[model samples]
Target: MAMFVHVTSAANAPRIRRSGIRAVSHGQGDARGVYCFPVLPSYTLTHQWLRELARFGSRGGLVAVHVRLDDDEEVLLGRYADRARNAQATVPAAQAVRRIAELDDPRGWEVFVPRAIRPRELHRIRTAPQVAGWRYRPDAHGTRPCTCFGCRVRGGYGARRLRERLPHPLDGPPPPVRVLLARVAAAGEPGDPVVLREVLHWFGMRRRGPLDRLAHLAAHPDPGVRKDLVWAVAGWSTPGVGDLLDALADDPRDEVREAVEAVREPE
Candidate 1:
């Protein structure tokens, strides 16, 4: 059986194990298992861990590291560079685990195995396979702003300002944007992240309109949904936008309050 080690916070250990991987503790003395690292800002990337990982990989162990480029870009990039320098093919977490499972003896594969694409190339390629039933906007500009969770956490001013100045999709013709808004309104409590993201993007695509329906969702119980709603309204100069933001500025959740305050209009 394939053994897996997750080097993340204790809080995330349960979630990792629930995914069917036998998450072992760090000091379990099981050095033969594949080690998985999640590159989050909260996790400290220490030199000791790097050295241990290098030693493990050198001895034919698999290493799977999931990186969010929008957050801690330089740090994660440097770690990934080290992994590539060590001759480990950096594949996605899921793919890496599958490959490890298929191999009877991981050591059989050469350390410097050359694949069709390098890790850097794979990093540059952005695809939507991870998000099922979602499609990229055909008209999306390469320089267009992204307000997704990762981008927001990264806190890029250019992207945030561009998104703020853009218009709302609801202000456009009644096609996909209208259809998407309807779905968002009809969605049950605690909205879906994918749908919410697209809706927020739509809000950033057009400049004028009340978007009353979205304003109503500002009171969503989920703080994340409420935060997205705040961001959607931050760019609008339409009627009631200020009042809506004012109400959210005092939200019970600190995250919601911070998000609203970040873009709230001066009183």
Candidate 2:
């Protein structure tokens, strides 16, 4: 016996039909348990992680619990891009369901388990397909993304219009405050901190180039390029923008000294 599904978040199906599928583990340091996928005689590769776990659902409904491990239960398995790699973590549960049913692209395998699943080995929850699998991984549709700065997603929603329409050579499409004032006046290295924080997210538009060549990027040693040069000169009223926000409020990076006191608390 071997069957699995998981998918999740139809408002967690009534607390997983009361105390059943709980093992919760999310982001940074992942691996607490209960991450399924394996029933594949391909029902879309057995619910390939329903649109990447319905992108952390805050209202976006999704489901699919289904269970029943039995065959020497004890899983861990691998490769959803090496679930934070550590090599073939344990096995058994019917040999990780016959090693992803003899994979011919088991769409990036994954199977965890490590504890909770009770409500008598579940076996039903239903209503899935909130736009089926593959969102930010697995065969990442036609490639070219990984824009690097740890795979881009800060301030996400359309993230700066997808980095100015597919940019990212070192992350950007930003460069013309007259060619960044000729690369900060022909320097030995003033550039790539993700393209100088994408050209300081447009120093509040219509060009803002010199202040002694942007006050030496307030000692820029990359706190995301001095929090994008204190958020592109936080609405400058220039008079050396308060001594470049007092030399970036002595930034040692608490997000560039809290964005230099959120740009001097809205003056």
Candidate 3:
């Protein structure tokens, strides 16, 4: 089935293209196929757009809505006519894309969408300068352990072990650095959030030789990877870093441009 993705920010375009979906203009009239919307807080659904989507649904077009409320909660909605189906799961974006790819028809929409629920609002304290940093304080009495598979795996010794295994900048190239760089080289699959996050974390840790080797990932096919790479290279003072930031400044994704602006020093 042909899929059409309607997005507000250029950042979402690369992901849609990688998914083999066509990008449709907001005012396009021929979007009568599978409609996909990536809901973000900054964009509001206009009345005309809503009416058009409803009309598309009434005409038997399928609608897919993906919402990421926080790190812990995500909701996917599917609507046809007045009937709606949704699914709430802690699956990463990559897994969600795979689930959507499995559906062959409208009848299988619910398989990708589940029933939705109201998400709890999250609040964080912003440090001075707004860009300086953030302080997150969870409710001590109400806090509970996350039981999602990814959380469980992260809670294990993996993160700790990885941190411990990272090579010291003064030690020159180390075994862990080689291994991490190898993973960075093989991170070509679309929507593989886990691998990309790990690679980004490793690159963010030290600004030594290994990080320089990963400058190529700045143009990774996955926007998520590029976003993380921008953050990882933000603090570097290398000449290549400046050129990389300049190239990414014109990126279609506003998120990438914002990241570039964040690290860019005033002239």
Question: Candidate 2 regions off by >4 Å?
Answer: 5-24, 27-32, 42-140, 143-178, 183-199, 202-212, 216-229, 232-258, 262-267
For candidate 1, what is the lDDT? 0.45
Instruction: Predict model 2's lDDT versus the native.
Output: 0.74
Estimate TM-scores for all models: 0.33, 0.31, 0.33
RMSD of each: 18.7, 15.6, 20.7
| Candidate 1 lDDT tens digits, 1-267 | 111222223343334334423333232233223333332222222111433333222323322333222221111111222443544554544444345445543321211112111122122111111111111222233655455443332333344454456523444322355776776766655677667766775675455555676776777766777787778777877788888888888889998899877775476
Clashes of each: 4, 0, 6
TM-score of 2: 0.31
Q: lDDT per residue, candidate 3, 1-267, as tens digits?
A: 111223123333334334533333222233222233332221222111332333222323322323333332232334322132222343543444445455443221211222221122111111111111111111222554343323333334344554345433332222366787677567654536668667666556465444467676666776777888888777766557778788888888888888888877586
Q: Pick the candidate with the highest lDDT.
A: 2
Which residue pairs in model 2 clash with each other? none
Model 2 lDDT at residue 202: 53
TM-score of 1: 0.33
- lDDT by residue (tens digit), candidate 2, 1-267: 788988777777888888888887752155577888777766887887787666645454787888988889888887866755566578888988887799777776788888778888888898876676687788788987765567776665676777777777654545567787665555447556765665566554433446667778777676888777877877766667777778788777788888778767855
